[model samples]
Target chain A: MPREVRERQMLDAAVATFARHGYRAASMDGIAELAGVSKPLVYLYLNSKEDLFTACIRREAAALVRAVRHGVDPATPPDRQLWEGLGAFFTHTAEHPDGWAVLHNQARTSGEPFAREVATMRADLVAFVTELIAAAAREAHDDPELGDREVAGLAHALVGAAESLAGWADTDGSVTAKEAASTLMNFAWAGLGNLMEGERWTPR
Target chain B: MPREVRERQMLDAAVATFARHGYRAASMDGIAELAGVSKPLVYLYLNSKEDLFTACIRREAAALVRAVRHGVDPATPPDRQLWEGLGAFFTHTAEHPDGWAVLHNQARTSGEPFAREVATMRADLVAFVTELIAAAAREAHDDPELGDREVAGLAHALVGAAESLAGWADTDGSVTAKEAASTLMNFAWAGLGNLMEGERWTPR
Candidate 1:
């Protein structure tokens, strides 16, 4: 097999192992056997367990980012774009449960460089959502009610909501990706739509 | 001082240390000095580092849950209740940044018992939000449009959004707790209000 194919197998095994057994408990021998590769080859190719885990984080994060980016088309209306983006996110997370677990569950808590890697991805996602919301606001009205800070806050909230929903769907098993996407879309877009129209919810 | 007072001091110090230096890096010596107690006294009171961290998690988690519960009035309208609940949540998180960090960041990734401790708090929060949303749905319509599963999903999304917004406010520093609460209230209430009125965002 090509080195690339072998490396992919190793990463797949590593993500599943890390997600199922956690970072501290996941063993190299198990990962090697799961990959169907020799222990020495696993070490030689991935360097170490830490490096292999880092590789898994980078690949999964990139894949998720790319999935959302590709799912959204700039030419589409903002709400549609968000719908597509969220659909893509939920679908990817649902399909790649192990990868999602690695990124959201394992890497984040495993410490140091791993957490930082996920943070960078999170920052990128927040920035992407921020731009999306800002554009939607500008398009909706001449004078947008959402200030930059508020827009930033909204983006964080939306991303967090999606993440939480994804985790929920993962655990519930019965919820499909489409259902997760719709749930968040209704929760977020209607809220954003109301905000755009200046129908703010104030304390009574 | 009495044991209860001394224990509170130790937990306060532990939470701050764990938040700042992280669980593993946080030292018994540092926590003891910060708590104004001897190292042996710290051990005697808290038992061990693991126990001290667990104590911090339990204390902070309970305090957070209590604050949110106390913030809402059952007699008030559902929307008002949500607003007050969110307001209370943001205020608590903002005021207790160290405790928030300990629960949100430190306890979650520290592994095993610590992670489970935070999960229990999270489940309780989710259940509380679920009940609130379900009550609102029932109040809004005789035949609620939101199914049980959908309501459950919305609860997860809302909790996730609050968590995200709290973290954002903590980092931005300029964003006050009131601002965070208001931002989410608008984002969530407006969306949820529309959903109650059957104004969902369908794909175009």
Candidate 2:
């Protein structure tokens, strides 16, 4: 096999193992066996267990970000865009449960460099959501009353909600991607829509 | 001082040190000195570094839950309840940044027992939110249309959003706890209100 193909296979096997057994207990022997390659060859190609895990985080994070970005259409109305974007995100996460587990659960808790890798991906997602919200607000009104800091806060909240819902979907087998997406849409859109129309929820 | 007071002081020091330096890098000597106690006495009371850290997680988690519970009034209408609950949450997190860090950042990534500790607190918070949503939905309609699973999903999303905003508030010093609570209220309540009114955003 070509080196890249072989490396991809290694990463695929590694992500599954890491997702199942977690970082510390996931053995390189299992990963190599799953990849149908010798242990020494696995080490030779990936360098070390840490490097292999890092590779998995990078690949999975890129794939997730790409999936969400591709799922959204820039020209659509903001609500439609958000719906599609969320659909893509939940679908991607549901389909790639192992990868999602690695990125959200394993990589984050494993420590410094790994957590940092996932943080970058999260930051990208937050920024994407921020732009979507800002554009939506601008489209809703001539003046765009939502300030940068408020937009930033909303983005963080939306991303966090999505992240939380994704984890819930993964654990609760009955929740399909569509259902998860709809739940978040029901939980977010009207609030965001109200904000766009300058309808703030004030204390009574 | 009494042993309970001494232990509390040690936990306070440990939480601060852990928050500042993280788990592995946080030193027992620093914690002990900060608590103004001998290192051996600290060990005698907390037993080990792991136990000390665990103690910090438990204490902080309990305190956080208590603050939120105390801040909310059950007799109030649901939106008011959510608003007050969120206010309590953000205020607690901001004022107890070190404790929040221990629960949100440190314990979660540190490993099994620690992560489990934080998870319990999170579960409690999610359940609290779930009840609040369910009650709100019931109050909004003669017969609540929102099902059990949907409420569960929304609770997860709301909790996740609050968690994300708390982290954002910690990082962005200018964001007051009231501002964080208001931002979430604006981001969540209207959407929730729409759902109660049977207005969901369907994909066009």
Candidate 3:
């Protein structure tokens, strides 16, 4: 097979191995066996264990970003865009459970470099959500703009909630992607709308 | 030293070692050395690496639960209780960063036995939050009760957001426990209160 095809196969095997055995326990030999390639070829292509793990992180993160971006349409209202994006996120994660685990579970727990890679991807997602939230606030003609810190907090909370729900959905097959997306929408969007209107929940 | 004191010391060492080097990489010899105990005594006290890790999980989980429970006064309203509980949580996690990492990051990623222990503690927390959400809904004399699943989703989202913020706060020293608690309260409570009052944010 061609180099590109061989590289893809090696990555697929690496993701599966890393997801199954984790970053430390996973070996190049095991990955090579799973890829149906020689161990030397695995080393030749990926270079080292760290490099292979980084390659897996990059491929999986890009796929997830592409899925969410493709699901969203810039023409739609902010809430609808968020809805579509979340739906796509759940669907992709469900279909690619190992990839999601690699990104969410394995990458974060690995050392600094791998963790940084995942964080960069997460930052991009947070920025995307932040833009949608700002757009919604603008369209509503809200008097006071949410502070940048507050927007960032909301975005992080939103993404964290989505991620938690994705794990829940993955574990319980009965929970559908649409259901997870809608639940988050109800849980989050209403709160954002309330915040924009200057309605706050203070300690009693 | 008394057996109880020595056991506590050993657990502390284990938490530090596990947090730094992860489960697989952390060894009995390392923990024993850190605890200033003999390797045989360490094994005698904790049985095995798995048991030692489990003991750490139980100790940290109980401490966390105690901190949150002690922070909240039952006589106050649900919102106040939640606020106080969150404050305590952030404070405790901030103070015991290694323990928090052991429970939240290392234990969960280690495997089934360790993950289940953490999950049980998490379930207790989720139940606590779910009750608060329910009480808030009842206080408002809402149109209808949130379904069990819906409440569970909100609870998980709330917990996930708190976990994410705890991490962010740990990384950025300027973010105090009080600030983290306040941000989460605003981000979560307003939306929850709105949902109870039959206010909804839908796609436009």
Which is the leading candidate under lDDT? 1
Which whole-number lDDT from 0 to 100 does residue B82 have in model 2?
Answer: 95
Candidate rank order under lDDT: 1, 2, 3
lDDT of each: 0.95, 0.94, 0.86
For model 2, residues B1-204, the per-residue Cα lDDT tens digits are: 888999889999999999998899999999999999999999999999999999999999999999999999999889999999999999999999999999999999888899999999999999999999999989888888899899999999999999999989998899999999999999999999889988888777
Tell me how far the alpha carbon of residue B133 in candidate 3 is from the true structure, in angstroms, after superposition. Answer: 2.7
Q: For candidate 3, give the DockQ.
A: 0.55
Error of 3 at B116 (Å): 3.2
Give the TM-score of each candidate.
0.98, 0.98, 0.87
Model 3 CA deviation exceeding 4 Å by range = A21-40, A48-50, A110-112, A134-145, B24-40, B73-75, B138-145
After superposing candidate 2 on the true structure, give the runs of residues whose Cα lies further than 4 Å from its correct spot: none
Tens-place lDDT per residue, model 3, A1-204, is 899999999999999999988898898989999999999999899899999999999999999989998999999988789889999999999889889999998887675788899989998898988888878777776565677677777787788889888878877788888888888888887777778777777765
lDDT of 3 at B33: 98
- Which docking class does model 1 fall in? high
DockQ of each: 0.92, 0.89, 0.55
lDDT score at residue B48, model 2, on the 0-100 scale: 96
Q: For candidate 2, list the clashing residue pairs, or say none.
A: A191-B191
Estimate, for each residue in A139-166, the C-alpha lDDT of model 1 and write its tens digit: 9988888899899999999999999999
